[model samples]
Target: MPKLMNVRVTTMDAELEFAIQQTTTGKQLFDQVVKTIGLREVWFFGLQYVDSKGDLTWIKLYKKNEPNNCAGQIMQKLFQPNELEIYPTKVMSQDVKKENPLQFKFRAKFYPEDVAEELIQDITLRLFYLQVKNAILSDEIYCPPETSVLLASYAVQARHGDYDKTTHAPGFLSNDRLLPQRVLDQHKMSKDEWESSITTWWNEHKGMPREDAMMEYLKIAQDLEMYGVNYFEIKNKKGTELWLGVDALGVNIYEKDDKLTPKIGFPWSEIRNISFNDKKFIIKPIDKKAPDFVFFAARIKINKRILALCMGNHELYMRRRKPDTIDVQQMKAQAREEKIAKQQQREKLQLEIAARERAERKYQEFEERLKAMTEDLAKREQDLQNAEDKIRALEEQVKLQQQAREELEARQNELQEMMIRLEESKNLEAAERQKLEDEIRAKQEEVKRIQTEIEIKNEHTRRLEMEVEEARQKKEEANRQLLAVSTTPQHHHVEENDHDENDDLPNGDVTKDLEIDSSIVDPVEERRTLAEKNERLQDQLKALKQDLAQSLDETKETAMDKIHRENVRVGRDKYKTLREIRKGNTKRRVDQFENM
Candidate 1:
């Protein structure tokens, strides 16, 4: 029975886990990876992992492991504890005349519909950052402009996530923190100064949001050394358009869609003769017995130029090795590999130390956050308590105001009743004055009738007096005659008639005296003056009532204003306390975070 080893494969875009038989070659895993990811152009890439020595070495797909290699052996020998990364050995280069590296062409399934532009930009930025990181690590610094752009790309990546080609890429000219850790260490750069410089540049250029700016950075990253190399389109004898790329290794030819399985490869070590004419690129294999020939028709536009460039690159690749250089070259390569392994081990140990430090810092940050949160909660509770107290105070104030309003209303009612009484009194005074005037007029009429009666009586008395005077004269004459005729019998009769007439006159004088006494009345001017005084009193009462009403309104307004001002002052004081507490707590938390 074959035991299976659990292997985790890392690809350019994803990580895959697989279970393979220990007896199998690395090719088995690679084949599965290619199948799972649907990789079409895959030859230029390989699966690699860091050894226990921390040296990153390729997994040889063509070589078979020893029979003793089991799952444990594979784990101990091939895989790292927690790392798996796939790096490219060669990149497919094609005509990019119409292609822009800043722009990403989307594919199906990788990107979701209605995805945010920010997410796409973030991913794009990450890809560029990875490239920049690779360049930095490889020390591929040459062109100043190119290096600056690559560094800028690295800055954007650190701030954002890796880029996915299936999504739209971001714009570039925006990130401010462009100095990556490697660059900082390499140049002994002051992070603050570098950041300030980038900030100034960003401000001047109207910097983009970090995500959207990735596309612009991607364009710059793409223009790095040896990036976007064009592959020549050639026609084989089978009349198929083959994509050909000449690198330091050799000539590589393949179908445009599938690069993992190349149809023909002319390694520099295996080549015998290579030449190109105006219209063709000709190649002859090293083996004389095989007698196989491979010819490529040049591209239509830059055929001669492309052939020339290929010949030049090939010569450079071939010249490195002399006729008898195999054993010496292998020894040199082994020594370099060992040295790289030691360096990698040291770097790994440093990385572990750094990771531990980071963890401690993160833990401290967590503790600070917890403390801050607790303080915030306590402050909130205090605020709530203060708010409740304020509310209670406000309620008490409102109650007092209500009571005051009720009392004021009662007072207002009393004043209103008093005013009503005054009105009634004024009306009564008016009625009394009218009654007195009517009585005065009646008394005057009675007096006038009495005067008329007196005048009539006087006139009658005058007539009587005149008559008496005539009688007196007659009486004197009559007394003389009577004396002469004393014995006449008519004298007794005359005396009796005079007595009756006098008695009637005395009765009339008595009635006239009674009428005169009844005609006299009290002074009317005194009553009139009393009425004027009552009217004046009524006017004064009305004025008093008006003043009282005005006072009530003013008092109410003053009381309300006082209550409102008190409430505002109390609320302001409480709010100020709350703000101070919050500010203190926030400052403490910020300090803790900074220290962490």
Candidate 2:
């Protein structure tokens, strides 16, 4: 029986354990984690583990040859152990308990080239947010103090809804680690001051959704100098310590002191091959004229990790060049639908919460007033009983009349307010309707214009077609006439010196010959005229065909434009209808409140 190994993979929020064969490849384990998380954009993530050397390494989730055949097989063979297979001997730690399961962290190993455009899935974005937040807090990525404060505010908003004064008092962030220790150490302000600055920014994101807040955080984080770069401490050929960085674009070498800027860069497109043996790594450029990049790591384990990262980054770079697969398309569509649904749900929930809070406040106020009025009435009744009972009755009647007048005035004011709001809503609705109508009319006019133009082009095309056909027929007829003129036999006159031929011919024949000679036309001149006319007809036919083709192309473009406009108009109408429905619901709610 094969041995079953208990492997634990830690994600952003939770740890997942899986029982697999001891010989399970990295690809299988990675796939299991992705399936468990329901992550569609798997390209941006990788499973990270601490090797025996205490260096972080990415698990090779795919075969090297899977990306391309050029250098894949060679690299695959060079990095033995089946691309860092899951083995107890490789990952076991001396101080750790033997009974504990093998641990791995599922993390965002790569970032999108463009966050807003490429990062589509909410789940993917959330994972990135969690990883980036941890990095920022841990000082793994260097963030300026100002930018760190801004990121911390977004983090706070994402974690705890909005910053409430009652809940988030002083020392709220003191216990929680928001910014890096370095950032705090550099600033002279107290912790309270930093919290206040963060709260100021947090207040501005009051109603922002958690996903939006997270997205905003990522957008800012992506701009930092060390955002998505994975840095490895290594030595150059000169024995100088340097940092080798690998990111989505390419590999970069940073100086020993400065991590913000790179000393040299090699884009993935320029790189032809990457191979390493022992602690020696080399990067060959596509341009033979350029020298190869050679660097050395402290341990062979580090070289393996660097190679794995480079391969993965290169594969992703190539993948992005191709079109999206069907699965990707479906995932994008589903993510969009889910995003819209979640937004609607959050809006509805917020609306309900606000309305409930308002009602509760009003009820509390009414109850307090009623309690005070009851106490006053009781005191008055007590005093009246002690004095004149008849006077007490008059006082009660006056109090009742005063209360009625006050209630009437309040009701009138409310009615007036409702009326004003209703009038304003009506005016806004009228303006919106008029605008929509005008837009619809304009669209209709545009459509009609395009249609009219298309019709004109079609008519012109038909006319050109007719002209081309006529010209072709004329050309063919001219060719046939020229052929007939060429084929026609000509009479040959015998010389007068041939006495025998003259004696044999009758005088009538001679007179006939004279008449024939006089009636004969110049065939060469006639043929030349027919040929010229044919050439002219051919030129006209060619011109007509060219005009017809141009008209057809114009007609096609016009039709496409019409279709695009119609789609836009339909989308606008749908949006307007939704807005109207929402307005109607609001009006109904107001009416119900007024009645109550």
User: What TM-score against the true fold does each predicted structure earn?
Assistant: 0.25, 0.55
Off by over 4 Å in 2: 62-99, 277-279, 353-596
| Winner by lDDT | 2
Q: Write the per-residue lDDT of candidate 1 for residues 394-468, one digit (tens) a residue.
A: 556556555655655565565556555555666477777576556555655655555565556556555655655
Off by over 4 Å in 1: 10-16, 23-27, 34-43, 49-57, 60-132, 137-146, 153-189, 200-218, 226-596
Pairs clashing within candidate 2? none
Which TM-score value belongs to model 1?
0.25
Minimum summed lDDT over a 10-residue window in model 2 is located at 88-97
Name the lDDT value of residue 378 in candidate 2.
60
How close to the true structure is residue 472 of candidate 1, measured as C-alpha lDDT?
A: 51
